[model samples]
Target: MKYPDLFPFSWFKGFRPESNDNLETKSPLRQLADIISSSVDQIDATFKDRGQKYPNLDAPFDPTTPAEATALSPEVIHCSSLIVAACAHLSATVNIPTKLLFDVGGGFHLSAALGVIIEGNVVEILHDHPSGLGVYDISAKNGMEPTRLARLLRLLATHHVFIETSPNVFKNNKLSSMLDTHKSFDTIQSKPEDKYVGTSGISALFAHTCDEVMKGSAFLTETLTDPDIGASGAVEDCPLAVAFKFKKSFWEWLEEPRNEYRMNRFMLAMEGSAKLEPSDAILRGYQWGNLPPQSLVVDVGGSLGHIVREIRNAYPGLKYVVQDRPAVIESARQIWEKAIPSISDGSVVLQVHDFLKPQPILDARIFLCRGVIHDYSYSVAKLILRNLRDAATENTELLIIDTITPYACLDDNQARVGYGIMGTETLPPPTPLLANLGKANAVPYILDSQVLVVLNGEERTIGSFTELLKDSGWKITRVFTISGSSGKQILAAPV
Candidate 1:
């Protein structure tokens, strides 16, 4: 069987038992395996030492029992999963010669190039001059050191971001071409005299993730161990806040005028994520067509009315009221005016309202909150839910669109026995694979950590959600999955 060149590790071809004889050898593969073994051993020791520190994460690993049969806490299981992912990444890095160095160096060069490209419009210049520009000329135009800039471009060329045809000439490729600002507007969000220029949505997301998110993540361990913040559930005490030494919450910090550019990038990142994920899942998975004509739907904390607009386009007869913060609502109104003409006639109503406050809209047919609750801790989440509940009539339906975390165990029975009421059911994988789906669930697991680091929030298990809704005077009725999406539409009603 042929495997992609991107992953050249022979172990990925097929699983085979490791020979005892190779353990003592010093071959590249053996060295890689030894490194992984040593790393796992170290991690195991660390977990054992600190296990008592976090009672919530104290799940023992029983080698005597099969992995499929053993029960692990979500925290323990998630940490173990990360270790496994790190080992795989290390193995791949070591097996592929120069890959490790290239990746590290590429990140530095790419970050530098991104700064220059965004400020000097380097990509736009390259787009116009496809024949290629001399290194000195390009460097001079961008106000950079010629030799250093040339080396950076050459390094990026190895990854196909640019092409270095000769000693000093360079031209953009498909990857580098994307950074070019193609829009007619001079500044982000079309704000006149705004120095922070705009780029494509995806490009903005990449820049935001690489420059901001990664910087905050670098201090994760320190943040997690801080006495004042380690166990705090407040969003203001999260890892990102600790790393940045901020007195305000993440959202509050973003609202500052100095961070307008960053806020725009963050918005674009969310928009890009919505495009990639199945934003249409809620529209299609629910019984929207069955609703009476002119039925009202309230979008709670809806940002820029993106999801609401999509729903209106599909079901024109239904009406929507999008509620959010005052500033956000004003921005949404402007966006709707330009992109959604129906807003003027009240088909789409933009209202300024905070979700934590009592929901003023009462007796609406549906109260939809997408990608909102996950940004909050359980206490805040309950408040938001309770507010909706107070405003809800018997006929009102509550729809929460978010990722539902799955357990690592093979069966619901084991999960129940191990985690009791906190455990949700998990499907078994095919034979020879780990019961937890291993690398298949990496993205969601990582996203779970991201929420913790950024907002002291979390992705929830089905059991967790059930418990949460029950406390808020609501009960989950159904969970709808979308094809090719990691998100789920959870339907509930007031109990």
Candidate 2:
């Protein structure tokens, strides 16, 4: 009945999503790290391309290339975007209320880190980052004593944390929020009361994707897969691994961390994204008004019951249940008891069942799967569908919600994302030439070399799903999309 703006992402909003509610700007110590890293990358690229001669290193910055883009990938600077993505994972795992926590963490990480740089000054930071301190607090505990004012001021000015109002006085902005633990731009008096930037989107998720290649891209996926799991290290090659290895290995890497720093950050990132809100925002675009406010929608592999809670909120009289692994169920129980729910009135029922096993029978009118089925291999996914089919009564509606790949081919097409919950991807072979030994592109041909990398699974195209579903005795009846941007749809009937 009362759906808070369900979908709110604008693709052309230029760069990273910033709250229109602007924040007081202060330069944080971390901005220095960001700047130094940017400068080094530009010089490296330029040197590598232009050769030994420094063609009159005249104008240090090249006007053509964007300073930030040339320095670091957009993904790195867009920590806010990282929060948005992480929130989905967290909602899927823990539930929705914590979205606020993540939002705050991200925004704060930006504000505080930047604030430190502004007050201390950025120039000196570029030279060296002191012990246990980022760019901020380097001089704070002591004050310009050993750190040198000119060097420090130069770094600070270069950091651009604040624009000079007079001489050292500066202007405040969203970027400036990084400076103070509290308030006042160019004040330089003392750390604000709200200490450590008052946690927001900068939480664990930011560190996870930015630090680990495994979490951000498919390096781990590519590396773990051994296309030739066979003795000779040669095979026909597995498409599933190639298509979805990126996400699969990321979670695998997530489960394993070198230290508490890595461990805490990764968990936080995941916790941030696990919301009832569907990743594609299709829920916002479509109208559920037609359906007679169904009794309840049960989510399979639903983490932390976030989806259950969100759906419950969306359809007043309707209720929800989240089905997941025993360990995950335990985690969900813990999260719900401690935090707030994203919606009111709608209740959540938790069901623990192995997807590889059977679906628990319930009276729910709609059986929903969001980014769920994509986690399993075709055979495994089909088995999941069969389990749901066996459990569904004629009155029950089976809704399979996931990203569907269009059959049409594009010159530079990107593959759809995997469900990203629980599934494994087979490793790529040592050598495509030798490892792509005998497996044909189509089915009926057994894979000579396929090894599960662990937890990461396969991604599928609609045509691929069509064939797989047919084999499993289900027929697709209708297709749904999120205003044609991110989410997918499928209305299926049992054979």
> Number of the top candidate by TM-score?
1
Off by over 4 Å in 2: 1-203, 210-264, 274-282, 285-294, 338-347, 406-454, 483-485
All candidates' lDDT scores?
A: 0.66, 0.43
User: How far does residue 139 in candidate 1 sit from its true spot (Å)?
Assistant: 2.3
Residue-level lDDT tens digits of model 2 in 310-382: 5555665666778886757888878876774543333666779776687776576677776677655566677
Worst 10 residues of 2 by lDDT: 429-438
> Positional deviation of 460 in candidate 1, in angstroms?
3.4
Which TM-score value belongs to model 2? 0.46
For residues 1-495, could you state the per-residue lDDT of candidate 1 as single tens digits? 110111011122112334546544555444445444543554455456654322221122222333212213333343344345445545554566687666654564566566555555456556657678888887766566888777777767775677887898888765676565554323332452333234335566666655666566667788778888777788888878877889778889899888877887778767666665544656767789888999899999987888888788889899899988888888888877887675778788889898889999886999998888788888889999999999999999999988777665455563444233222333343222345545535566667777887787888877678788899999887776655455677889899
Among these predictions, the greatest lDDT belongs to 1
Could you tell me every candidate's TM-score relative to the true structure? 0.67, 0.46
